[model samples]
Target: MKMAGIETLSWEPLFVMRLDVAYDRAHPVGGENRRGIFPVVGGTFEGPKMRGRVLDGGADWVSWRGDGTMLIDVRTALETDDGALISMQYTGLSTPTSPEAAARFARREPSPYEDLYLHTTPRFETAHAKYEWLNRVIAVSNGMRTDDGPMYHVFAIT
Candidate 1:
């Protein structure tokens, strides 16, 4: 299932695991913009299949499908002092021209896979939140973002 402008690829096995995130109010201080890395551990035991686990807190769990999509839902539970459950989903695309590109992610350490034309729908719980305009990029993933205005290259790298 490809989303028009974004490129999709077949099943490429990547590491999958359920992690217990310690709660700290200032933990995600920088939010998404803050770049950080973590070591993921899980091999043949949970390899190339649907893997899932329930987190300690309620309404929290994570599952990782072999495909390339990572399903993450971390809402509401964060208000507590404990922590939130994490789930991952991977959806493998069959149309990628390069098979090796998919294989590269199946390893102990995987290189970054770029994703272009990624559309994100904001989830605002309260009515007080104000919506803003979408940021326009010249290009991503070696292709253009908006076809109307100017040409911007965006590639579905990840």
Candidate 2:
């Protein structure tokens, strides 16, 4: 018997987004996790297709699990250079490469991107005709934590 082959997926560079985040203390929610809220105060993004500033008033609701993994749900908006507003949301998983790294992160210390696994799936919505294409693309991002916030290299699935 012969097996069918699978096609490899490809990606195209979309943008690089650096979010200036404000952290809030995490408090125990209950049985197995702690919850925290992080505000997206401001930032900037640039790419081949677009460039803009990240609007204020967005936030990330984070859950720190007992198993040392962080689950993040973020909702933010972007204002293009030309003034088009786009809403963006993403869900992501963040895991430290080691127990020490996890401790450092908990203490709000910065870590190299290689010291953690941080990945996100982002969905974009826009009413601007110039950016309508974003509404239909499947996007993914790899991110790293910084002292000021987090920066992500976003890509579009092809």
Candidate 3:
């Protein structure tokens, strides 16, 4: 068997999104796991090439896995300052660095980003000609939980 050699990946800064979200108690889905739906009430994103406000109707459906990792599924809408609308979605994982960190997160304590391994791959869609480039790029993000909700530093793979 042979494997092809690939070039190293590079990233280009896209935006920083900070969300304001609301969470309700999760319900058990099965053995040692639970599910929760969180509403993304509001947020804003800014970067060198674009700026936008996150629409209020978006949501994040989270799965609390038995192994203590949080599986994230998020869908959201964004309105550029110029009125163009974009749809964004991502699936990611948030795993605690240790059992104690997981416990702190479960208690809604202030667990720093250093205490968790959080990463996401985001996809973008839009019909607006001005930003059509987004439709073809691959993107990833590094994320952290905040008191207000979560913050992400999004980048496009090059």
Q: Quantify all predictions' global Cα lDDT against the true fold.
A: 0.25, 0.89, 0.87
Worst 10 residues of 1 by lDDT: 130-139
Instruction: Tell me how candidate 1 scores on lDDT.
Output: 0.25
Error of 2 at 84 (Å): 0.9
Winner by TM-score: 2
lDDT of 2 by residue, 40-134 (tens): 98899999999999998998888877788899899999999999999999999999999888888878787898878999999999999999999
Backbone clashes counted, model 2:
0
lDDT, model 3, position 58: 84
| Candidate 1 local lDDT, 115-151, one digit each (tens) | 2222222121222112111121111211111211111
Clashes of each: 37, 0, 0
Candidate 2: give its CA RMSD in angstroms: 2.5
Q: Residue by residue across 31-135, what tens digits does model 3's lDDT show?
A: 445777788877999999999899998888888876888998999999999999999999999999988888878776766788789899999999999999999
**Candidate 2 vs candidate 3: which has greater TM-score?**
2
| RMSD after CA superposition, every candidate | 17.5, 2.5, 2.8
Regions of model 2 farther than 4 Å from truth = 1-5, 24-32
* Cα deviation of 109, candidate 3, in Å: 3.1
